[model samples]
Target: MAVPLLGEHLLFTLRSPRLPTHAGQVSFPGGVVEPGEGVVEAALREAEEEVGLKGVEPLGFLSPTYSPQGFLVQPVVVFREDLPPLKPNPEEVAEILLAPLGELLEVEPWSEVRLGRIVWHFPWRGVDIWGVTGNILKAFLEVWREGKSPPHELL
Candidate 1:
């Protein structure tokens, strides 16, 4: 999930040391959906749990992507009127980074592995964002740039 603040910045989290997977990596505040839970519900719940984020209004959802680990991730875009004082849960988050959307938009993919495969990396502060999280940001920016609504296939 991406949280857009009033300053045109987006929120990202550094994974906690306690996490089994992707520890210390940069990611959005989200996790696996539990049984019987919808994607939006799960995203909201995880955001609240991991970052104490509240009062956000959902803008839309980007196209879902499958992780290399085989989990389907639905990226939700949300808006906040202003930046909130975040209380990150130490067990799930190490630090919160607010990146300017303009900088993110200006970033070119760091590498192109194949004809259709491009690899992106965004380094904010000292942390690098890549892999699935990077892909999510790239897709979201594309949709935003085109001024098109998020794909209806998202749910």
Candidate 2:
């Protein structure tokens, strides 16, 4: 999920060292949906739990992406006029990062063929956002830049 903060910045989280997978990696605040929870509900709940973010309006959902680790992720876009003070959960989140959207857009994506497939990486500061997160951001920027939906097949 993407959280648009005040000043057009995007919110991200650094996973805690205690995480089983992707530990210490940078990602948007989100997790698996529970049996009775919807995508938006799961996204919001995770956001609040991981970063103490609240009172955001749901903009829309991006295309679902399948992770290499065997999970489907739905990127939910949300907006807030301003962000509240954050208290990151130590167990799930190590730190909260607010990155400017324009700066992120300007960074060139690093790509290479790995295991017979192309993988893209976006390095922001010291965080390397790759895998599913990078793909989602690429798709979001593509739509934002073109001002139209991406190819349905691409989604």
Best by lDDT: 2
lDDT, each prediction: 0.74, 0.77
Residue 107, candidate 1: Cα error in Å is 1.8
| Poorest stretch of ten by lDDT in candidate 2 | 146-155
- Candidate 2 segments exceeding 4 Å error: 2-6, 113-118, 148-155
For model 2, give the RMSD to the true fold. 4.0
Note the residue pairs that clash in candidate 2.
none
Cand. 1 Cα-lDDT: 0.74
Model 2 residue-pair collision total: 0
Candidate 1 weakest lDDT stretch, 10 residues? 146-155
lDDT of 1 at 105: 78
- Residue-pair clashes per candidate: 0, 0
lDDT of 2 by residue, 1-155 (tens): 55444446778888999999999888888887889989889999999999988888777778887665657788988777666788999999999989887888898998765554455789989789877777777777776667542222222
Please give the lDDT score at residue 43 for candidate 2. 90
